[model samples]
Target chain A: MSKNLVGNHIRKLRFNHNEMTQQQLADKVGVTRQTIVALEKGNYSPSLELAFRIAHAFHLPLEEVFFYGDDPTQ
Target chain B: MTYQEKKSIVSLISAILIFGFYCLYMYPQYPGGGLESPEAFRFWGSFVLILTVVSIVAHIVISIIFNIVFRMTTREKEPNFADELDKLIDLKAFRNSFFVFVVGFLLAMGSLIIYQPLHVMFMILIISGFISDVTGSATKLYHYRRGV
Candidate 1:
């Protein structure tokens, strides 16, 4: 299987946003705090909808929040 | 832990308790020696009683503990995909259990053809199937939570 690297800086974004917590981001994005933690740790890749929500939560464009990161799709 | 993880733990504990009770107590001590005993009603009553008590107690304790610890936050509502994944895991786990049941049933039938006492086989098949499903689902939930 191709190990397409998917990465995000959700933690950094949260920090930039007044040290926003995973719970806060999850509340804003309508996802679980655990999901935010997973995304920040690169342990989970969000769906398109979730991606958009996260980007919106951070007040950033989708590309700015989530990067494919040498993904095979790219 | 996620809701899925908590649910998995509860299920696994319940299964273990049921399997243990069946294998250790009911399987050997019950009337009719698992199948052919003339006191089938008595055996069934005991089995049902034990199962109900254990399940109820375990469920209550698990619910209480889950609520106190991980279920504290109302912000993390269960997601749709997470619920779907749980159901999918449950179905897959049940399929695994069914496979065990089928194998046990076949074995029992073979023994019957040889005039062997196959009474215990019926109980064994069903209980084994349940055990298989419970363990499989618990493992899957653990791996999923671990992000494997």
Candidate 2:
């Protein structure tokens, strides 16, 4: 399938937050590690609720956490 | 691979194996009566019923075994609950699977309209059921690997 348009800085943000692991972030956001992995890999666009939760996990605004573009996540 | 991916693969393989072995075991039991005979009808009825029960039991046993192996190899416990992603993928899988079965049901009815033997219709229905099961598993695997 084509890559998802929605992208996020979850991997980088997780690291910035004391090098948090995928499982830890998933726990904080109430999702499975696979969902976190999918979001970081740009394979999925989380629902608004899940997106907000992830943003809250990083203490960042939604725009700062997620962006919609062809730009790849670093 | 992640646990979800691995689980999807195991499900696909197990579905194939279970259906294959069950068909093999049942093939020799086809009734000797004429295609439209009462015995033939009874055979098909029991066949479908037994197959459903067997598939359910086998899948549960295989899932338990797979969990044991996964834990031993990866040292990670299986997630006990389905999350949003899992639910989404499952819904898509079910949609595809149901679509396939509906098509098969139509074909089976068409066979009767065409004056094909009753046994032919039965076979079509049974094969369609098997294909739908496989389709569901394959769809889950595809979405898990390639994205929603």
- Top-DockQ structure, candidate number: 2
Q: What pairs collide in candidate 1?
A: B32-B37
Candidate with top TM-score is 2
Point out the worst 10-residue segment of candidate 2 chain B by lDDT.
B30-39
Residue B58 CA displacement from its true place in model 2, Å:
0.4
| DockQ of each two-chain model | 0.26, 0.80
Runs of candidate 1 with Cα error greater than 4 angstroms are A1-4, A71-74, B1-7, B22-29, B32-38, B41-57, B69-116
Instruction: Report the C-alpha lDDT of model 2 over A1-74, residue by residue, as the tens digit.
Output: 89888888888899899999999999898888888888888888899999999989898999888898854444
Which segments of model 2 are wrong by more than 4 Å? Answer: A70-74
Residue-level lDDT tens digits of model 1 in A1-74: 22225678788888999999887887787766656766776766677788887888888898887778753334
Model 1, B87-130: lDDT tens per residue?
Answer: 44457666666776677678767667788764555555556556
lDDT of 2 by residue, B1-148 (tens): 8998988888889888998999899999988857788989999999999999999999999899999999999998888888889999999999999999999999999999999999899999999999999999899988888888
In terms of lDDT, the poorest run of 10 residues in model 2 chain A is A65-74
